[model samples]
Target: MIPIRSAGPADVPVILSLVRELAAFEREPDAVTATEAMLADALFATPPAAEALIAERDGEVAGFALFFHNFSTWTGRRGLYLEDLYVTPAARGAGVGTALLRHLAGIAVDRGCARFEWSVLDWNADAIAFYRAMGAVGMEEWTVQRVDGAALTRLAGR
Candidate 1:
């Protein structure tokens, strides 16, 4: 069984490295702006904004899953939202990704989450297939919208 555990302060550096690897794998090698300090604060701060799980294979770090909770007014309960899941190239086909996903699903069930959800890049057929194989269905009716950087500042009237 792949060992999955909660990430601690000591795992900050490795987690950041894995995040960079994920960014590169997503074809955005220069998109990562997260630093160890930023990650640590986000993961370990008072009422942490997010949480991370570390998966290990053969006593080595295999991948990580970073997630957070969101409220669903419709369901009147919280939902689990996976922000990122990355399994190293070497660990790709070794069930590491499956194990991490299964772990998160269990967490969602244990926490009474109304739903467990995440978005995958359309170009990543492999990931799409993987998620489909795990019983995930695409919400074709919904399209995600985002506003950040200068636009966010302007929207906030700052």
Candidate 2:
């Protein structure tokens, strides 16, 4: 059986390693630059920027879901954005993903979040179907935008 719980400092190394595995599965192995110390700072430091829930099976980290809360002024409500979710292939098909998602939903409900959202690559049909199966509606009307590197710096300094 998969055991789920909020991650603490002792789980940091496992979390970082699983993050690397997730990046590799996405075909972007070089993308994960988050160091263990950096994660400790951002995730466990005072005034935490985000929170994570981890899935473990037999004491091994099987998967994780990282998320943060967002505010919606127009709706006058808060939203929970699932930033990253990954279950090792060896751990898939064993209810890990479903458990993680359901756990997130419980938190959203407890916090009175208006919505729970996440983005999946268009090529990842399996995840899309899994999400749909879980009663998630496709947000086709929304377009995601981002700025990074120098662009982010310029925008922040403006």
- Each candidate structure's TM-score, on Cα atoms with residue i matched to residue i, is 0.98, 0.94
- Residue 155, model 2, lDDT: 94
Q: Pairs clashing in candidate 1?
A: none
Q: TM-score of model 1 relative to the true fold?
A: 0.98
CA RMSD for every model? 0.6, 1.4
Cα lDDT of model 1 by residue, 8-122, tens digit = 9999999999999999989999999999999999999999999999999999999999999999999999999999999999999999999999999999999999999999999
lDDT of 2 by residue, 32-99 (tens): 98999998887898899889899987787789999999988977999999999999888889899999
lDDT of 1 at 79: 99
Clashes of 2: 0
- Please name the candidate that would achieve the greatest lDDT relative to the true structure: 1
**Each model's number of backbone clashes?**
0, 0
